[model samples]
Target: DAMVIQNPRYQVTQFGKPVTLSCSQTLNHNVMYWYQQKSSQAPKLLFHYYDKDFNNEADTPDNFQSRRPNTSFCFLDIRSPGLGDAAMYLCATSRDSRWQTYEQYFGPGTRLTVT
Candidate 1:
């Protein structure tokens, strides 16, 4: 089974328009996280949910939101795709299977381009 998958490995959007990226996993972990990376730099945590406990990064914008309706699926919704929003959207998960350690495994990422 595919542990983690992201659709549309690349995405292009017009500035100020809404865009969305999807992520799914079979790892069956309780916690799911979203991150944004630019220019191949370190992934910046946007926000995450720990079985319903929502956590947002300090730098995350109001335009970005996430939804995890169930354990196997999650989504990132960017209400307004800005020119700066043109970056890589990464979906990652930590194996909450072991309460002792929580290490995040990242997907290949969805690259976003602004036109």
Candidate 2:
């Protein structure tokens, strides 16, 4: 069974403060995800990694950072979270990146609130 776990399902931080959100998977899927979803908009892929290879979206801002130390873990770090940075940070995993179509297992997400 594929399952994703995200710690601190709800997080609150002050403006310009730094925060880190973690995601871990038990199935050890090769592809780990770090994306942002604001309100009703679709989840935007900030960056992702399969093992050690990473791919960052061209439009992703520098303030958003991601790290994957091993196959099972990933982290999203916001250097200086602004008011607009408050959003639902979602973590997901898939088998691999080569497939044309694949299903992703998603964590419940960590909702970041900035005040």
Candidate 3:
């Protein structure tokens, strides 16, 4: 479905060696984002793309990276993961253009383990 968040739920994660997950929306929202969530934790914005515009959280680790070369495709690249890196990777998008952060939907997460 368009204008919706797929896989809005996820599993608990443990300390991690490396893990990567994904999300996509058919709505073609101009802004797309990836969030980090720990077990029993709140979702945290890792990074997002505003139609080829890349924005990263100040505290986000260097191990985390992203790419959006086209309108409908984006990727999350985790160079190296640590125990603390074990968390949900959420993909989301917003309809608003001209750089606005609005309400978003979530995707089912990929659980990771650090062992």
Candidate maximizing lDDT:
2
- When 1 and 3 are scored with lDDT, the better candidate is 1
**Local error of candidate 2 at residue 45 (angstroms):** 0.8
RMSD of 2: 1.4
TM-score for candidate 1: 0.92
Local accuracy of candidate 2 as per-residue lDDT tens digits, 1-115: 6689998899999999899999999987888889899999999999988778989999999999999988889999999999989999999998875656478889999999999
lDDT, model 3, position 53: 83
Writing each residue's lDDT as its tens digit, candidate 3 over 1-115 gives 5643434244333344344454566777777888877878888888988788899999988988888777666667666667667666667777665556477765565555554
Local distance difference test values of all predictions, in order: 0.88, 0.91, 0.68
- Model 1 lowest lDDT segment of ten: 94-103
TM-score of 3: 0.77
Flag regions of model 3 displaced more than 4 Å: 3-20, 99-101
How many clashing pairs in candidate 1? Answer: 0
Ranking by lDDT: 2, 1, 3
lDDT of 2: 0.91
TM-score of each: 0.92, 0.93, 0.77
Among all windows of 10 consecutive residues in model 3, the one with the lowest summed lDDT is 6-15
